[model samples]
Target: MIEFKNLVKRFGTRTVLNGLNLEIREGEIIFVLGTSGTGKSVLLKNIVGLLKPDEGEIWIDGEEVSQFTEDQYFPIRKKCGMVFQHPALFDSLTIYENVAFGLRRHFQLSEDEIKARVGKALNLVHIQGVEEKRPAQISYGMQKRVSLARTIALQPKILLFDEPTTGLDPVTTTAVNQLIQDLSKKLRTTSIVVSHDMNCALSIADRIVVLDKGQIVALGTPDELKRSTHPLVKDFLEEVLHA
Candidate 1:
């Protein structure tokens, strides 16, 4: 459903992503694993046109969008829903309003339709009640779920996650990982997750792509990665094993 060819991104003297190439299949969960500054988040941003590639092409659903203007990229962004590292929910908006915000803005739906979508999205994330409460009232994990509820309520065909479990405790991280897998399967949307957790990736991802210096160093299923001999892949595996 998504492909990147010879991709490159730079900031003045620094090249973050270099000659990166990969493909994400439809309805599959693909985890991108790398240490800090390996261009994980940059990769996600490039997909939704938050950042443009300097040298390569980005193809989504067969359309090359490396140079699409902001207005022209609107439809592409509508087809992709990105969950940022921060929940970034409005403090004043109630949970329902927060979830319904995108629906109201991007779509022309009645109050009843909005309510139905809000309910279904919250239900998918296993969040119940608290519709009238604000972001400050809920637990952080629930807040994150509400954020996810807000994104999925728009019903995008592709889901992009940038460090979805960044600050969570281990249990919450596991729960969030499971939720990603479940949502991808249930909604039949292709998922691209930029994360640092290899253990969770092993248990949940259809494929894992390991990046080093903005290039793919290892790409395989969990079992295939277990036998990888690359130093970076081994380093990641060591951390996972010793954890």
Candidate 2:
């Protein structure tokens, strides 16, 4: 339910997104794969209206949002929930407070409603019994789960994940990948995950989009990508397989 048409973003002499044309279907999990500096995160930012495109348009739910002002973009932003590479949780706030932060800012709800939503969000991420603890008191994986919980609590229509499995052990990476898959299936939230992790993409993607030099190099199912002959796609897959 999102479409990008001839999208372009430039910073000085460097062009990050060059005529990007993509369509993300509703309830589909798309994994964007690329090396560093390939505009994967830029794509996410553009989709969320954090960074505006220099040319072309971005459409969400059939509405063009490229020219929307901050006031007009507020509701669109709320419909999207982003999970950064880092959890970005507040060290000073307890887990429950952190998860409740957005809900409090955006909506006026009774304490009981807030508690139930927070509890359900945590359960969705398979996190439990840490509501009273601070972020520092939890493991890195748990902290990531809390970050996800906070986002899911908003009941967003779109979920943007940037490097969701970064900086974790293999076991935790597996857990996080599985969590992404589970959440996408259960929530049906049009998830777009930006990651270079081949295993993660293969494990979770309904389709994989490969970016290179500010452009889409390939887009296909995991099996199709595995059989691709494009030089860049082949090289990238080889590197991931060997690394």
Candidate 3:
């Protein structure tokens, strides 16, 4: 489980997260929804230990992550995986090499083991035949799949997705959404997604947490969010519904 207790982060005069408190349980898919600049991405960065909180504690499975040193964070980071808004693949590398990048850099595995792991990761995302192909050769949807394959290759206990379906068409968006849900269930990994796309959120989120000005304004399942009486939520939902 991941818990953020009274977390606070500031950049000079700007406050990104203000006493942010949240709980993410194991094997659950949690979605953080908000308008742009509401600090949703910053919250994800804190959870992954990329940024430090100026105040309060972050606990991952009972360990005080806020107090962890760089060395301590290394092992913890391995247990977490992240998929950025962009596919973020290296254009020069083949799909096989891209997926194997982390394993080679972080682990002491042999060539045979690396190959096996890379192949398995690709197969998990239905991209087995694209191993030798460069990332630029594939469609945008396929690039996203390759990115997901790289993330799952780490076998993280928690997966953080930042707008996974942002640029895809409705069909591709639906496919990516289903893939997120399927991969979360199959791997039993805790999934946390940050998105403004209600379709993606409603499709895959087991629970939704809405933020306004860096504070949680509502938390509930998809149905509850859709039927919420809060004007702020209703307005946001309506905008997405129409878009």
Who wins the lDDT comparison?
Answer: 1
What are the RMSDs of all candidates, in order?
A: 0.7, 0.9, 1.2
* lDDT against true structure, model 3: 0.90
Ranking by TM-score: 1, 2, 3
TM-score of 1: 0.99
lDDT of 3 by residue, 1-243 (tens): 899999898999888788988989999999998989888999989877889999999999779998777898987899899999999999999989999999999889999999998988888888768889998899999999999999999899999999988889999988888989999999999999999987778877999999888789889999999988877789888887798
Better of 2 and 3 by TM-score: 2
Whole-model lDDT per candidate:
0.94, 0.93, 0.90
Q: Measured by TM-score, how close is model 3 to the native structure?
A: 0.96
Candidate 3: segments with Cα more than 4 A from true spot: none
Higher-scoring candidate on TM-score, 1 or 2: 1
TM-score of each: 0.99, 0.98, 0.96
Worst 10 residues of 3 by lDDT: 196-205
Residue-by-residue lDDT tens digits, candidate 2, 1-243:
999999999999999999999999999999998889999999999988889999999999879999999999999998999999999999999999999999999999999999999999999999989999999999999999999999999999999999988999999999988998899889989999999887788777999999999898999999999999989788878876886
Scored by lDDT, model 2 comes in at 0.93
- In model 1, the Cα lDDT at residue 22 comes to 98
Distance from true location, Cα of 148 in model 2, Å: 0.2
